[model samples]
Target: MDARVIILLLFSGVCLTSAGLDKYSFINERKTWFDAQEYCRSRNGDLASARNKEDIILMTDITGWTESWIGLNDLNRETMDLYPNSWRWSTETKSRSGYMNFAPGEPNYANKEEECVDIWTEGTWSDGECSSLLNFVCFSGPSTDKTYHHINLNETWASAKNYCRTYYTDLAMIENEEENQQASSNVTDPAWIGLSRRAWTYSEATNQSFRRWWSYEPDNRSGKQFCASVYKNGFSDMGCTSKLPFLCSDGIARKQSRIKIMIQSNLYLTNQHNKDNMLQQLSASLTRAGQTDFNLSWSTLPQKLDPASLNDDHQ
Candidate 1:
């Protein structure tokens, strides 16, 4: 091949390689045990089913949380059934024959009626109630640079729009299926987004239009659902008066850092209210420097270093 042609082929190979690597990145988020499974399925993957101690620890660190869901379920409450044998993997590949590496009396099936599987800190499987709400883990296509912002309180559709505009660039908008799935992970409460039915017609919308559907389904049944968010993967016709969390985007770094400092200072003051006046003054000064929005009262400070020593000092 000519030198130029060879160089072109090498460049193309590098680009393709980068794209392929990008497709395998792991996403981290919290979801209902079932939603986690569905999220993985939607992305052509499954809930992270850890098969060994190392894998479990890695997952624990990835989530930075103690407990999360795995893809194990006891569809049949058979006590004699050994897990990894009785339980089928969510991905549905053939299960590798394995031993029930329980820690002492584990898989206790505690009630002999437990039907779900969860990983304990000991790196072993235990039976849990399937219906009980627990945080779960889901694996999917590679992660992206998508950022999320949570709205503080409920607001009218117009007010929500204005808030996002004034603070961030626009109300949170999902660009693709990956972003949509990722957004669902952060939401603990219902939130508002850029999508609306009354503010704009769905037909005139572009692919990037402010309007969005939670899951791929649009809410055409009710006259509400004029707002959107990352909490649920679908839209609901909810009244605007009903307060729910909302989403924002494009946050400034300095503002976030300042907010975090203020919160920390407030927490410190709350815990150190009985300290010396100098310390109390110092806390107040720090709070002010942080530009905290809340008031920190110091009028209740005790006059004596130790109230019990009041009589002793007088003596």
Candidate 2:
């Protein structure tokens, strides 16, 4: 008796094609928190974004790989020297609820010129250079249409903002995902999303809204441990300089993979049976990891293995 299996991983449809969706991987390189962020973006995506339990399992699955730097952090430390003050919002036009939607590894002040935001059509957000041009969304006060208005025009963040104030109200202020949805309802493409770090807007920023903190976590020890990391069980706070291996995710493009395996039935029926079971498990794992669209098939080798070749010194 003999058995064989083939497995394939593929990306199909709009959800998987999204430019800013997260696909996670474990990195074995060690670097400080900020350094890890740079490394991840330079190579993969940003530090791993665990949007929920499923993502958390994907990032922290391999046990003993603790202290891996993630994307969340207290962003004020970098500018303590230039500003000499605590964090503050970019503008006073915030809603009473004070909702925010920053993308992972964002508002890092990575680019000195990044003091505004651009929300993509897919819903994820990122900081934008203040002078960059894009269409914008706006909302008015009680006097006018208070929902949202997508202005299709090219203008810098400052100009777009001013236009809103002059005509309707301040640029659209999104206090939560609900408002994010409401603002996006008017725009079918990317646009300025009224978010920035003018005066150190918020202390923390990341696309993920979920957290899994370790015991007594986020201690902010020594007044410098601002970045976040994950351990075997949960998360902990660390300084920007603490070097450690990290995790990352991919969003720029879709991924595809092919795997082929052969069964040596001549050895033993038990062995062949075990190999068949292993492939079944592998198929399950690929699906569990959010890989839904794929193509798979199996084919016998054109020829059986030559027994003599198994030896190192074959005649």
Question: What is every candidate's alpha-carbon RMSD to the true fold?
Answer: 26.8, 19.3
Local accuracy of candidate 1 as per-residue lDDT tens digits, 34-73: 4554565666554443223444344444444323344333
Q: Model 2 — TM-score against the truth?
A: 0.39
| Model 2: lDDT of residue 25 | 63
Q: Pick by lDDT: which candidate is best?
A: 2
The whole-model lDDT of each prediction reads 0.34, 0.59
Whole-structure CA lDDT of model 1: 0.34
Model 2 lDDT-worst window of ten: 199-208
How does candidate 1 fare on TM-score?
A: 0.20
By TM-score, the best candidate is 2
Give the distance in Å from residue 271's predicted Cα in candidate 1 to where it truly belongs. 56
Model 2 stretches with alpha carbons more than 4 Å out = 1-21, 77-206, 251-315
Mark the regions of model 1 whose C-alpha exceeds 4 Å error after superposition. Answer: 1-85, 97-101, 141-315
